[model samples]
Each structure stands twice: as structure tokens, then as C-alpha cells.
Target chain A: MTYCVAIRVDAGLVLAADTRTSAAFDDIRTHTKLSTFEYPGERVFALLSAGNLGTTQNVLARIARDADTPGATASLRSAADLFEAADYLGRALVEAQQKANGAAADGVNLEATLIFAGQIGTGATGLFLVYPQGNWIAASPETPFLQSGELKYGKPILDRILRPETSLEDAARCALVSMDAAIRSNLSVGPPIDLALIRDGDLRLSHRLRLGQDSPFYVEFRETWSTELAAAVRGLPPFEWEAPRAPPAP
Target chain B: MTYCVAIRVDAGLVLAADTRTSAAFDDIRTHTKLSTFEYPGERVFALLSAGNLGTTQNVLARIARDADTPGATASLRSAADLFEAADYLGRALVEAQQKANGAAADGVNLEATLIFAGQIGTGATGLFLVYPQGNWIAASPETPFLQSGELKYGKPILDRILRPETSLEDAARCALVSMDAAIRSNLSVGPPIDLALIRDGDLRLSHRLRLGQDSPFYVEFRETWSTELAAAVRGLPPFEWEAPRAPPAP
Candidate 1:
């Protein structure tokens, strides 16, 4: 299991993902799930992956291989636009799953889901969720976010705080808060959290950070959020009967 | 689908449930999911249900019928203790599911899951989660809460705020917050919300409240929580570079 989220605000895009990967309770490892393909001042793409580690790795390796292969027609760099990129990535994901389908007789879910967000040739910025079946949906103004893997625990915050007009920094903070809640509630997700911000029209990542469990910033953020949430709970309106009760007759 | 939660704290027990029931996305009805069997100074039990509406209704009806039957040997009134009651309820649930199993041949799920909490005689107060297969698990000091139906969206809060030493009132508030989050994230769960609290040593429920969408207290609580959460988000520590960026060279 994994957790990744991407928010597309008016300012730009905020993407975050957990690094913990577990084949079983006893076998766990840390592996970064965020991948980037940057062409400096031209086009930038960020891919956040979740699901079968093998499938994601295969798809990613295929993309990297294609990019490195001279005159390859199926590389991320070859896609003309974000939509085409989503389509191309979806096809790659399906191909990876199909290539591994022969050994998936043990009922292990070989499917992988991904969030593809980036800029293409100075065109409109886009964020898409590529499904396991090779279909994709782009985020719209009304739904300015996409998430994959262990998403429910963190979704309420996103649903509440994200909007097209939200600032990039605030959206990024909200993503962290969402991820933090998921990590605390579920063991399958953990840090060194990876976060990247791509400002609208910047054609490159504005900031990319990896915060470990004890990193000062991550620690401060978690502690503050926890304290604030506890305060929020304590400050809720008291139930009518919670007021002081009269003493029984002496 | 529905959302129901029960929290057992040192002070007492807090149980809440949503009322919406849906057979399909287009067909939704409001039906109470929280049912109380209170025999003042004797035994008290609150049942919070989720899953197949028909199966739940059948099981509930059977329990009510058995309790009313003149000489039923295994009714709620006849159970020797809380464990016995849980056993009886679990069996009833399985029986209900079996009775409807034939009609459910089309793969429509007839399984029902429930959270049953209350006190019987002078024995310790208890909370049990009854599964569809007629098995149940009791809540303990380490895990003082149990939830059923659309549970994930609301779980992080409960994981953070609930403890054996939590006050009953606070637990109740937390349950409301949990339900509210679920309602916001999942359309299958909605209001009017039902709440019940049972204080230890008091065999009967201390409070039972049904809050509608327009109810003054419910509305106020929702609004206040939303406001406080927005404030909490706004108060998060600013990222270093978010302080203020210099105007870009024109």
C-alpha cells in the first residue's frame, strides 16, 4: 500500500507521496514513488505512483529506457501535450501489467495506479489520474485534486481545504497535512515524505523536498498539526448536559 | 451504506450512527441505524448497524420479536451476560443473512456488520462488533472504539483523539466529528444523525439524541468545526520560501 496526492490550484500544482513500501507485515522497505522528467525551460512532468511495486517499477523503467533510447517514439519527451502524455503513460502502465500477467496467477494484484501532473510545450497545465485499466481522468476546476492509494483517511482535509484559487503554498501544506494523517492512521504509509511544487507556467519544478521522520520542518509541522487538532477538539461546543450539574441534596 | 461508531471511555460509552440508507445511487431513504434496548436498572444495549438494509432490518426485527416473545429462551432479556448477548446477537445476524441468502443469489451482498454496546446486570459495561459470520470482538482499553460502514474517512480522528480515559462527552463529540467527516466524503452516509450515551453503573442510556440537518445544535456544531478546521489549516507553519517572493524581473 502507498499514498500519493496531487493538488492543482490556480497558482500551480502540489504533489506529495509516502516512501514506505511493504510486501508483507514483516517485509518493508523505503522506496521513493515520485518520478520527475524535466526538460529545463521546456516541459516538466511529475509522476506519483501507487500499487504493485513491480508494475510501477517496470513502467517507470520503460519510460526511462525510452527516453534514453535515441529516436524512440514512445518517450515522455515525445508526447505533444499533457493529454497525450496521460494517454501514453496509461498505455505504458497497461503494457507493464500485461507483461507481468503470466506470473500473477497467485491472485496478487498486479495493477498500478498513477497521478501524472506536468506542463507541456508552454500549453495548459494539467493533472490526471491514470487508472489500472489504462484510462485517465483530468482534474477540473470543481475537483482540483487527484489521489491514489490509502486515500480515504486523508481525503476529508483535501475535500475541505482545496480549491482552484488556493495558493500553491497552502495547497502544499494541505497535502502534507493529509499525508501526515494517513501515515499516523495507517502503517503502510510512512516518511521520508516527498513533495514537489510546479508553479503555473514555470515549466519546471519550483521546489522539491524530502522530509524524513525527524527532520526539523516535518517534526514541527506534525507537532503543530497535532497540537492544533487537539485544541480544536477541546474547543468544540460542549453538549448541553456537559455543564456543571447541581449537587444532590445534602 | 451507513456510518456508525461506538466509543467506550472510562466515564461511559458514546455511540453514534447516520440514518441514510441507499439501495442504489438514485434511491436513498432515511432510516434510523441506532436502536436501543433499554430496561432501566436492568440491562441496556444500543445497536449501531451498517450493510445490507434488508438483512439489518431482519436481524433487528428478530431481536425485537424474541424480546417480546413470552417464553423465548435466547432473547436479549434472557441472555446471562453481555458476552451471551453478543453471542445471541451474532447468531441472529447470521440467521438473518441466511434467511435472505437464497434471494441474494445475484451476488447482492446480504452481509450486515454491527456495533453493539451496553451493560447487562452488574457486570462490566461492554462493546462488541458483531460480524456477518456470527463472530464478534469486544473493545478493550487499548482500542476503546469500534466503527462500521464507510469507516476510513473518519478513522484518523478517532485514532488520534480516543482513549480509555477520554471523557464520555468528548468521545461523543469526537464521534460526531467522525460522522460529519464521513458524511462529507461519502454520499452513501448522511443525516439525520442518532447519538446515544451510556454512563458506567447506569444500566440505561443516559442520553439519546437525534439531530436533523436543520437542528440548531447540529448546525452549530458543524459550522463551528468547519471554522475551527479552516483556522487550524491557516495557522500551519509557513514554508521557508513562502514568506514572500521578490517580484520577478520584468
Candidate 2:
């Protein structure tokens, strides 16, 4: 299980994911779920994934292998646009899933879901969510964010804060808080957190961070959010006919 | 789809639920999912349910009909304690689910989950989650909350704020916020919200509220939470080398 979210604001795109991967309760391990590909001024892309680890690894390997092939015209490097990249990735994802489940009998779920966001050219930024079934949907002004795996627990904050006009840094913070909410509520979404920021019109990632539990800024970010949320809850108008809250018992 | 949550604290118990029920997107309806049975000076119970509406209605009807039977020793009135009440409710749920699906051949889900909290006597308050299969588990101080249907979206706040020493008023407020988060994130969950509060060491409900979208306090609660949550996201510490966030476009 995992939680990954990506937001496309006017300023650019922001993507975040947790590092925990759990095969079973006792079989948990840390695996980075976000990868970035930068061709400097030509193009830049960030891919975040969740679901069967093997399938994700396999799809990603195919993406890297094809992109690195000399004179390749069908790889990420040669995609006509961001939409084509997502479509290509979806095909790779389907192939990987089928290959993994081909050996296992029935009940083997080797599906994976991914968020693909990047700038294919100047003024051409896009975000998409590729489903396990190989279909995909692009984000629009009406829906500026995409998520995969354990998405609901983190959706409310995104619903309230994300907009096409939101600043890239603000969107990154919102993504982190959303991930923090998922991590706090579910063990399967542990940290260190992975975040990638692609500033508008830039052809490379402006920031790529992996914040562990003890990272100074990460610690302060989470603590501040927890305190602020508690204060917010306390500040809400009370129901009519309610008395003042009493202090806790000793 | 429904969203229901119940919290047990030192002061008492708080339960809240959304009323939206959707069999299909076009067939949406509103149905109250929380009920209270108060035998003043003897016992009190608040039940919150989620899943199949027909199955829940059937189970509740049986509960009411059986409890009303004269000389009955196996109804809600006859339960010696909260555990017995929960066990009884689980059996009723299983029976109802089976009956509803018995008419269909297969692939028809008729299951419902319930949260039952009550006090049979002084110092006898307890909370239990009754599963669809006639099994149940009590909520201890270590885990003083039980939720049914669309639970994850509302859980992070509870994981952070609920404890044995929490005031019932605060717990109730938290419950409403939890419900608000679910409503904001999903169309399957909507208003009016139903909330029930049971004070410990008492034999009757202290508060029972049905809040609609237009309800003054409910509207204020949602608006304030949204404002404060956005502020929280904006207040998080920025990463190294980050630029100041720009204001929204005019």
C-alpha cells in the first residue's frame, strides 16, 4: 500500500510520495516511489507510483531502457507531448502487470497505478493519473490534482486548497500535508517523504527532496501542521447549548 | 455509501453519521443512520450504521419489534450489558443481510456494519463495533473509536485528537469535523449529518443533533474548518532555497 499525490498549479507541478512499501505486516521495507527524468531544456518529467512493487519496478525499467535506447522514437524522450507520454507509460504498465501475473495463478493482483506530470515544452505542462486497467485521465483547471493508492484519507485537504492558480511552493506544502495525514492515519504510508517540484516554464526539477522522520524541516513541518490542526478544531464554533470545554483531568 | 463514526472518551461517547445513500448515482436518497433507545434511569444506547440501507432497515425493524414484544427476554431491553446488546445487534445484522440476499442469487451485497455504545447501569458504559457476520469487538481506552462505511477520509483527525480524557463536547466537535471532511471529499457522503452524544454515568442521551447543510452552526463549522486548514497548509515551513509564495492572480 502507498499514497502518492500530484498537483498541477499555474506555477507548475508538485508531486509527493511516501517511501514505505509493505508486502505484509512484518515484511515492510522502504522503497522510493517517485522518479524524475530531466533532459535539461528539452523536457522534464516526474513519475510517482503505487501498487504492486514488482510491477512498478518492471514498468519503470522498461521506461528507462527504451528512453535510453539510441535513435529511439517511441520512448519518453520522443513522446510528442505529455499526453503521449502518459499513454506510452500506460501501455508499459499493462505489459508489466500481465508479465508478473502470468506466472501466478488466479487471485494474483499485479496491478499498478501512477501519476505522470511534466513539461513537454514551454507552456505545455500536464498531469495525469494512469489507472491499473491502462486507461488514464488528465488533470484540468477543474481538477488540478491526481492521486493513487490510499487516496481518500488525503483528499479533503487537496479538495480545499488546490487550485490552478495556487503557487507551486504552496501546492508542494499542500501535497506534503496530505501525505502526512495519510501517514498519520495508516501504517502502510510511512516516511521518509519524497517531493519533486517543477517550476512553471522550467525544463528541470526545481527541487527534489527526501525528508526522513528526523529531517529538521520535515519534523517542524509535521509538528506545525499537527498543532495548527488541533488549534483549528478547538477554534470551531461550538454547538448551541454547549458549555465551555473543561480542562483535562489530572 | 455512508460515513459513520463513534468515539468513546472519559466524559462519554459521541457518534456522527452522514445520511446520503446511493445505490446508483441517479438513485441517491437520504436516510438517517443513527438511532437511540433510552430506557431512562435503567439503560441507554445509540446505534450508528452503514452499508446496505434495506438490510439496515430490516435489522432495525426487527430490533424495534422484538424490543416491543411483551415479556421478551432477548431483545434490546433484555440485554444485561453493552456487550450483550452488541452481540444481539450483530446477530440481527447477519440475519437481515442473509434475508436480503437470499432473494438474489449471487453478487448482491446486503451487508451492514454497526457501532453500538451504551450504559446499562452506573459505571457500565461501553462501546462496541458489530460486524456484518455476527461478530463484535469492544473499543477499549487504547482504541476508543469505531467507524463504519467510508471511514478512512475522517480517520486522521480522530487518530490525532481522540483519547480517554477528551471532553465529550470536543469529541462531538471532532466527530462533526470528521464528517465534514468526508462530505467535502466525496459525493457519496453528504448532509444532513446525524450526531448522538451519550454522557458517562448517565442513563440517557445528553444530546442528539441532526444538522443540515443550511443549518447555521453546521455551515459555520465547515467554513471555519476549510479556512483554518488552508491556513495550516500555508503555515508549514518551506524547504531550503524556496522562494516566497506569490499572491493569487487578480
Q: Give the per-residue lDDT of model 1 (tens digit) for B114-222.
A: 8999888878899999999999999999889999989999998888788888888889999999999999989999999999999998999899999888999999888
TM-score: model 1 vs. ground truth: 0.89
Docking class of 1: medium
Identify the candidate with maximal lDDT: 1
Model 1 bad stretches (over 4 Å): A68-74, A101-108, A242-250, B69-71, B101-108, B242-250
Error of 1 at A218 (Å): 2.5
DockQ of each: 0.61, 0.66
Kindly give the number of clashing pairs for every candidate: 0, 0
Model 2 DockQ reads: 0.66
**lDDT minimum window of 10 residues, candidate 2 chain A:** A241-250
lDDT for model 2: 0.87
Whole-model lDDT per candidate: 0.91, 0.87
Off by over 4 Å in 2: A95-106, A132-134, A243-250, B97-105, B243-250
Q: lDDT score, residue B249, model 1?
A: 60
Q: What is the per-residue lDDT of model 1 for residues A19-92, given as tens digits with 9 covering 90 to 100? A: 99999999999999999989878999999999999999999999989878888877888888888889989999
